[model samples]
Target: MRTSRVDTTIFGATSLLTLALGGVAPEQITVPAPVASEDAEAVAGLWLSADKTVRLRLDADWSYLGRVAGRHRAAKGTYRPEGTGLVLRDDTGLRTPVTIADDVLEMAGHHLFRA
Candidate 1:
């Protein structure tokens, strides 16, 4: 007599159910920690939103200036790489997180692209 074995797999919220059902053990997963950008020059430049309503200028001195509607000042601050992104410290002491991916910068729910 021959016997066959069935294999089952589950993901997300169902992983526990798989274990309870005596299915194959789920593999241990590991995620890497985010690291700050090493080369500041690489990200230094002018970036603008798709609709042209927002703009950000990243300078070589690590200082930044933001504008809305092309001329109205929205924010003036300094920026530095922090954990896979940048932390913009405004002159008023407000801090905002900006994520840099490719040629795009995401901050405060807005996406800015290199100009």
Candidate 2:
């Protein structure tokens, strides 16, 4: 069965509780490692939203900068590979998940394409 992130969190908590209560713990609780995407490098470049209102620039150093309407800052963050996507941690402590498929990138309901 495929487990969601919430499910994994619950399972981990349950395992910890069981151990704390002097119950036998399961054989092991494994956390999946982050997968390195071959597309990581390809993802580093300028991107724009469908309406051309939002612009996102991803750098090879894992840093990103986003703008709206070509001049207004929208987001600035650092990203890392997570599963088949990426986790972008912004300067304001907000984390956004980004999914890549073919030549498109999706994040927070916005679809972006290479510029």
How big is the positional error of residue 49 in model 2, measured in Å on the Cα after superposition?
Answer: 0.9
Clashing pairs in 2: none
Best lDDT among the predictions, by candidate number:
1
- Please, what is the whole-model Cα lDDT of each candidate in the order they appear? 0.81, 0.80
State, as a TM-score between 0 and 1, how close model 1 is to the true structure: 0.66
Relative to the true structure, candidate 2 reaches a TM of: 0.62
lDDT of 1 by residue, 4-99 (tens): 987775456567756775775444433324544556687889999999888899897889998888565589989888877889999999999988
How much is 80 displaced in model 2, in angstroms?
0.5
| Model 2 accuracy (lDDT, Cα) | 0.80
The whole-model C-alpha lDDT of candidate 1 against the native structure comes to 0.81
* Model 1 RMSD in angstroms: 9.9
